[model samples]
Target: MKYDKKEPETMDADPMRLLVSAILAFTVMLFINGFVGSMGGFPAFVAFTLVFFRIRTRAGMGNGGMQQELSDRQITGRLLWKYAAGYLVLWGILRIAFLISRVTGWGNINGASAVEYVRQMWNTSLLEKWAYFFAGMIMFAFVLSLFPLAVIREKVRWIRYALVDGAVFALVCLGNNGVCRLKFEQKSSGGATCLIDHLLLCGRMRTWQEITCLLAMVVFILVIGAFVFSYASRQYAVKNIDGIPASAGEEESRRHRMIRKIVTVGCSIAAIVIVVVIVLLMPKDTAGDYTKVAEFLTEDTRMGPMEYGDVVYVSVNEEADLEKNGIAQGYLAERGERCDSRFYQLAIANLLYTDPTGKTNLVQTAGTDGGTYAPVASVETDKTWETDDVFLLWDEDWALESAYSHEPTGYVACPADLIQGLRMQFPDVTYRTADFSDYDAYFTLRGYQNMEQALEEDPVDGDWVGCILVKDNKFYFGSYENQITGICLQQLRKVLGGNAK
Candidate 1:
């Protein structure tokens, strides 16, 4: 019997309803895939591939409607290629978005005043961008709504087109979260500035290993699954098509199949090469020291093995600043949680006690105040060693430039008793401060510039004031802008024991 253009009136299933159901099912599947990722152990690539194959197999069987048989001769390489290429492009866009989010604090609503932008985009008001997105999705569905009608009449390629487009739409929706996070960072205080500082001063990326592993897994799974699904769908179709199509339809289908196979082969090779290049380029220096530090810090075992140096100039309270700016707060709000605050005063106090000149009274006042100091000019020393670990620790207000240039280097200040306990532990360590005047001479001789000059002249923040230097038969804190307090000396002594002093 010849197939009719329209279905018989008794047909129970409404094509439009089936189309809506398919769209809704795919959307639900995409949401579930994301939820599975959050639960851990389930790979998104695998989940998506399984969903796609299930759709293809069901479509091939005609959802138990009119039976069809596919032909092996009709399943040309071109069709597989087209299908794979479409999926690959969709995957690429999603990957790029995910990368942006991971690097830039995107979609992390808790980060850097991100909530405002998120709220703006997703608010319930009709004017919100989210409403626009929904409208767009509706228009897209309307235009593609004819896909189910095509599938019902066995115009199989429309089903393929619809699936590819829907998959892309889903991936893009997921990736927009990352893009939103990027928007948040650009708007907030210390957002881009903090990013640039981390780039220049922080030196290396921390999550390189995990990134390499994830990329490797994703590429491997996508390639293997794409090929398997393509070949299986073609075989299933060839087995199922019962009625011969018009000469034109058959010719078109053959040409399409050949193109898809070619695309698949090209895509598989490209995916492999891209994955290899990314893995090879991954950063490998896991624990490289970004700063050079004092002698009292050791590389031995009682404490965890030592990391080489400090990462930046100021150990500012990053968490406090982030919270102030409305960045997402993490476990910090929990009571009694110890924060790894960069105690600059502890280092400053160590410098004070070690200062060769007894007149280094700048260190005494720091003990009474919270571990903060302010910019001070020294009449005794020609110029403050801006990079040294000394700052007036009492000032509630401090800026990044001040700490970078004006502060002196010493132990991060802690309670006085902590110092005494450390001294008792490491009695032999000879921790002492250098003369403030000598620090000026040293910086001049070494061709060093202060923090402000450095920031203005050299954008790299390369011009540091002082370091915990160890020369032949010489061991001492060399920078004098800030004096190392007795408090820091004690902590160092305790850490290094007799050998460090």
Candidate 2:
């Protein structure tokens, strides 16, 4: 009998291809790691492992083009030990860091004393926490670096792969941190500046602790990659012994195959159902509130010849009437002067009169003997206008450079005293102040312009002050440069409810 002989295929050991594949796999894993809680990490890791295996197979890296030439028993034993070790090391590091942070008074765990903090930490189920930590890290390592490390073991030196993998992981960490920082700054600053500028600014402002923590994280990641590579490489080197059969491409029994098929179909159906439920339960956008307010301002006959300057005259009576008018218009007017007038009126009404619970009251008072109303309220000097509910005052300047030109520019300043008084009066209400320059950011964040055009014209130089009222997590803004007088407050109070002392 003649036997046919086939030559074993030699795997392609392209360093660049391996490096790129590792980067892409890890990048995707990082992106999707926290997608659906810790469980999300498992699928991402599995996907990466599969990809790593395919890459190795195509390159003809191991026995029958597999990354590891180990028998089933050897592979299982090695994986269990590596996973256990990785989990223990990572959990220990985290626990140590937590303790150190507490001892140093940096943890700020509800202002607990060091003893209390330690007690609290120890009181929790450490085993359970460690179990979770281990699970996450084991999955992360397997998907992120373990498989890749094993594949490269035969082709490249372990030390070289460790160094290369560690460097790549460190770079990924830095890039991810930079991206997150940029996003946070954008949200805080309302996207006023470019991401590069924000990154540079934030880099300069990072505290020593922050820098240290970042460096430590990078080192930790590097160590993990190195450790995984070292352990996996050793496991792959082990020769098959008696009673330990190869696991790759082994034929399965009919029942086992049938069970596997059923499981796959079940998981697919469950995933589809979860997606459908999530879509159905998604929260409705609150942009419609701003749209409703805009519509009420434009179409309500009670708004009666409203003007940008007339926002000061808005009262509870007009407010109630305006709210009653409901969302009558479909869209806001163009962003010219007319748009500004409508915006101010709508903002004022929304701020003063939208409370459905009647917890707020507007009181009218007599005019101040001698007070001037200006378009912009000056923060250079002490000035106070008493309202029934609170005293409104502005005593200091808060300035910022222009986001567009990077030149010194003015911003609307809210008086600290006024804020304190308002807070005292209505503890539940939230107050935010914004300058004219911040209008775009403020409006965009609030989703105020459902169909309103961007304000193309430069903000009026003297018109700098604005007040934002936050109730039930909803924002309402109103602003005027004109100095508010006792008489003005009285008239506004009369419209609101009654006389102010």
Candidate 3:
């Protein structure tokens, strides 16, 4: 077919493709970088942007003439080899940086975070990190090079592309190879996957509303089919006898026109119904409705095991059934909102538990010896524990026997066992317990004598002590050897829960 001079050589560019590519690339990179312990995520974003532009340009060329004759294997192979070399070269530089850190004691490099592969280092060579970062970008570009090939070879590339895409997509979505392993076998380590597994367990099945929406969608699809079929049938009939013009065919033509008009009216109504049904099928977002910490705690049967160290943490509240408990201690309680420790405990617990629905798994406790620490604001208190029952809290008015040199009101709370353990395991600091009748006495003893004085002191100056809330009760513990954060607390809570706490 010859094209008219007025016709454009190619169709307009599809912005939709670019947008989709960008979103998919970002989501994949974020997940991979978070789980792979590589700083390649940002680079992957860069690679996707470049590839999107390149693809859009190539798309304008269309699959005609010479392009159509090219073999899929040859096209894909050339593209893959070209970008792979670029990516590897970049990765090579990052590898060198990693090797240097392993040998040198100068740079303070922290390993991968829970979410990304990028190592966080303080006082380290920024240039080196950047080198590795760029390498990740190159790798992503190489991966995306095959996107075009997959699209063009859709019929034959199902198995090939599906395998490749599945691996990449799973890794990107789940964060780590561990997750991917669980996805395929449903028995890797334990359970299906980590976060996804727990999410599925917590999430509800399709409700009646969702089912109704799905039914509506089916109806809409059926209507669309019926309308399209009728419209097409009318057009087909007209086309078959469209040119005949005579008295004999005149009556037939009139009859066909009336039928076509009726079909057109029916099609229009069906089209409107389809659109309305589709709109109704869309899902809506809603806010989370979780109870507050204090409220959740006071509820009956809230007691849960929290295994930390060698002992399990049992609830110390009077309401809890404490008949067989061996120890008990009370720590000043902080406001529910200020207690960030419990959230961290939950996050880590999800990571540690192979079966989140209270299944057994043997995971080593990091204990006081194993932890990532950073300076933070906290309280101080001391108490002896004869039983496993423990209570942790922060009193706004609680004061110490001696003032925390840097701050007026700081306290630590733990049962006698933990205090003794801390002393035996980590003996540099002194530990003492304070008994305050109420918040006011607690602050007065700590030297914060007044709330005004407490406000003047820096919150982060002292050793890190904080509350870790399990299912209902709070356990107050102190660490002198390392710092504890909300993240570590969550992991500890999960492990401790295994011991029937």
Candidate 4:
């Protein structure tokens, strides 16, 4: 039974209902976006999705539409798939916008040229472009609106609707996209300098940027004006209560069985994979948080693999600065927390009692665990260093670059009391700082430019370098922190204590 294409049949569903719902949904969505940020738009989007799809697919089926042939449950099942597809489309739009910004180095003060920028960022990470998340909802609403009308006899007509909806969405998104903003480090004379006040930083744009910005603005205006024209001309939005073109006619399908089977198998595979991933990610709550400080104390732990404790020391500077390497975080590791911070000040303060030139001032550090710090081991020892436990230091210390570095290093300004209790508990093996002149001949030097610069610049942040031990008799040198294990530390303490047994 073929229906003639007079005005293509109709349903009692309110034609203006979609427009009203869209205005309300998008208004609420955009308003809430400011409070919750871009991510918060998801729930608002889903809410809008559910509301809009319910109309063409199920709610209006009662008056006269093809969807009336299915039960509410069947209609709901179909609507959910439509909702999911629409979500993917919206997500893709946002991802593409974010990709453009990422590839172009948007908002980065240190942005390089496009080619170098893309090369550097290609392997890095993709961050969200919030404009799509915020303004893209208008386009997404129109996309969702098209899904229920997929079965219309004039199927090609949906393409026209999509084109219009997409134009509106894209235009709205342009105002917020990175293209509309200034990115380079160039000084802005002021937005008022441009005919338009700082829209996409017209005052700061190079010739090309200006051309692109103006072109986009012109296109956006034209497209938006076109929408107003289409609406005014009754070619869009103004509609008759026509036949069931929007899910208007019920039809049978020979491929229904095959499609259902495929969907079931696909869902089953997805469910199993999801369950496995979730189980694998579940934390082992029963595991204890014991950390052996000896584990990571190596020039390179990879040389002789250590099961290295759960205490991975991240950089305090690194945690603060995303660009720098994270080697300095050892100063603040708590005892039981994952990523233990310790050893910088504790080791430095342990140096000499009277040298007077050390850079470290024992500042009370707050632990990552949100607790007051205390020194776990004291540097005070009446015992003389008759054994002469000498150590070579680096700021990785600015002292490593000084003339005094060639002389016997002495500790200065050590704290009588220390912070977060310096979590590392070393055996009583007394030691003193010594210059690297002791091993300049034997050591292989390969510190990076950034590391060396950072080291020479800051004296207090000496955690960057490992402590090299010199036996002093014949230039026999080794790293104290890297080479010494828990087992070796215990043996040295016994031999030093004269309890060889």
Q: Write the per-residue lDDT of candidate 4 for residues 290-405, one digit (tens) a residue.
A: 22232222222111111112222211111221112212222323222222111122111111111123232121222212111111112123112112222122322222434356
Per-residue lDDT tens digits for candidate 1, residues 187-227, read 22121111111122222233564356346535644554454
> Which candidate has the highest lDDT of all?
2
TM-score of each model, paired residue for residue: 0.24, 0.26, 0.27, 0.27
CA-lDDT, candidates in order: 0.31, 0.35, 0.33, 0.33
Q: Which window of ten consecutive residues has the lowest lDDT sum in model 4?
A: 346-355
Candidate 2 lDDT score relative to the true structure: 0.35
lDDT of 4 at 459: 23
Please give the RMSD to the true structure for each candidate, in Å.
19.5, 20.6, 20.4, 20.7
- Could you give candidate 3's per-residue lDDT for residues 1-501 as a string of tens digits? 122234223323767656756775675565444333244445556555555445433323322212453443343333434444544454455556655654453432433242222232342233333323332342343254334431232223223332344344343334433423443433322322222332222223345743563465456445433443343223222211111112334556778978866765555555445434433542231111122121111111112122322232222211211212212121111222221222222222212111233222222112111111111111222222222233232343233312445453334333434433433443333221121111111110111223342345532112222332222243323322233335334444443442223
How does candidate 4 score on lDDT? 0.33
TM-score of 4: 0.27
- Clash count for candidate 1 is 70
